[model samples]
Target: MKSLGSSCSSRAAAETPEASRERRAGRGALWSAWPRCAPRDLAFCMAALLLFCLGSLFIQLNGGPPKVLLELRNYLGESTYLDDHGPPAPKVLPFPSQVIYNRVGKCGSRTVVLLLRILAERHQFNLVSSDIHNKTRLTKHEQVELMRNISTIPQPFLYTRHVHFLNFTRFRIEQPVYINIIRDPINRFLSNYFFRRFGDWRGEQNHLIRTPRMKDDERYLDINVCILENYPECSNPRLFYIVPYFCGQHPQCREPGVWALERAKQNVLENFLLVGILEELEDVLLLLERLLPHYFSDVLTIYKSPAFWKVGNLTGTVKKSMPTLEALQVLYRRMKYEYEFYNFVRDQFHLVKKKIGLKSLLPISSHEPSFLRELTLHTPDPLEEEEEEVEEVEDDAKNWLVQP
Candidate 1:
């Protein structure tokens, strides 16, 4: 009986070891499966990282999305100031003024907006605006909505801010006189370059460290992508992509497609007006005073820059020659169509200014264009008399007046 009991105990002990081994094998299988599962896990992690980086980059680029986000958040619940609860119905903005700010990046757009806001406080015009700040890349629907909203606002609007040329398409009923301000493209581009380059370094520590080297082929996609992340719905026609749209090129051909494109183009010309502030701010102001008599009575306030306030008339002195012959040609090839379009708009503006008696309001100097003089006046042609001559006083002692 004792031997039999010992045998049963031994059999049970042997089975226990086998059970433990099976459990160990199951754990080993789980470990082997880890590498196969790791990729999905890594993908999720990588996507999260990209989103974080993009968000950070956009905030840095746009100069604090935090403030804008806060404003938007507040606005979401209270759709309009004219909504039910007596927040003062959006009345006809008393001033019969239209806003046509030719916004160059980093060229005092914010200051202009602030200035307009301040002016609004003092004046009684209704504040009419779509006010889509930091929205540089927009779909057609959004553009339509923005115009539609602004169109309904009774003028003269007390104030509108952050509006661009394309926004004039909404108003069929009331046509407001257009006003805009422009800076030299070169100066504007340089200012924008430095602004993005330095602003990120100072504020956020290499957040915008990816400053794109200026390209020759007119490819600005690198910079455009950076700017677009933040301003997803901006319809600024001045941007590189929108140039095609503004010119009535593809996607905006005015055929079976959208009338929005054609409307936007005309509004940029007729409804939108720009004062070339780059050439002469004072002259531009004088013109503005004449045109916007209701808004300007005495000397209008000028916005002073915090930095570079006393910087001399550096704008003219800083001459940027075209990148290189090869580069210039390449760029011309890529952007010739848009360049022609821009020139067309520029000529139209010139004509409009002349008709309105605002030509003198533009800055004119006796100083001739040095580059033009060098290019046109001094070009040496083979047909012209050769300036280089070698005198031949021959080996002969006596020289007669002889024609060789």
Candidate 2:
């Protein structure tokens, strides 16, 4: 009976150790699951709420995406007057990839073409040659053929030619920007005349070497005779050149009249991105550097510095002597429209310089252009004078009504 009782006690002790191990194993699973499930879900919900709040604030401030881009104002510290809505539109624009240069004759356009070639060489843009090589206002079919070739010439190409301005859409150019230079009409016509006569009358042809079989000017033996004739084909045909070039190559614009003058001015304002004057080539260089940095990044430096401007005054093409006073008078009379167009362009350039506050173009010590400086010596435009008179009268009337 004693032996049997001792054996039962040992069996009960062995069973107690196995029951304790099972209780510890169940507690380990609950501890691991608490970290992986409930806390993670709580963190995710808080992040989502914070993102929603930030997105809502942005939408309220900017109105909407389309307007936000259009209204983006470059603040040099919160710019000019704005209504309760917001600020005015911007002026600083991104760079352009393609460009069209409508090269007017004897306007120092060759210099600009040289700059484009330099840009193409450095920046890897294509400087394409047009199929129609003639400078005279091309016939309609010739214009179409040249434009057709240009439209499909591929990206990053700069088209430089003595072509006149026409509607870009008619030629299928995508987002084209036009640029040109104009000279004093008298100077422009003279350059072309002597250039044909003496093949660079400056006695230096090294600047632009003549190719074999170059055509000589036999239009007239004497400069005076050329000017005296005032023929459309001969004697400095200024009427056929300046205004018609800007007014498009159409026949209507070719006729010397007010219609051509007005049309040319309108097209320049609407189509041309920039227009430069030949007399102020330095200003042109500075303006180009500032406005079209991507294309003319180092024009002044790489293209022979300030001295280059003086060398190309007449582009190695001024005659040893000039025409007689009477002949010149005849030339200017025929080219009255050219003179008006020249003055208009020069005035517009000055206005741009003033508005932009261009510091690099000219020095403070520099004087105004002779023409503008001596405005009192010349007759004012009748149209502008009438406008001034009307404003004066309106002011006097207002003063009379307000008198106490």
TM-score of every prediction relative to native: 0.43, 0.59
State the weakest 10-residue window (summed lDDT) of model 2.
364-373
| lDDT, candidate 2, 1-404, per-residue tens | 56877888777666777686886788887887775558779889889999978877887786854454445643233444675457766644335656787778778776777667777788666687454436757777877776777767656567877777756577665646777889877667777766655556345563235433444444336777655765544543445688877898777787878888899999878877778887777678778778777677778786675565565443566443555445655665676677778878877777777777854353321212222222223334458659778556434433432333
Off by over 4 Å in 1: 1-108, 126-134, 151-155, 158-177, 183-187, 200-250, 253-266, 273-277, 296-333, 352-404
Top model number, TM-score: 2
- Superposed Cα RMSD, model 2: 17.8
lDDT (tens digit, per residue) of candidate 1 on 16-127: 7779799899999999987665778989989999999999999999887788777887878656655656578554542445543435444445545555554555564454
TM-score of 2: 0.59
Clashes per candidate (backbone, < 3 Å): 14, 0
On the 0 to 100 scale, the lDDT of residue 248 in model 2 is 85
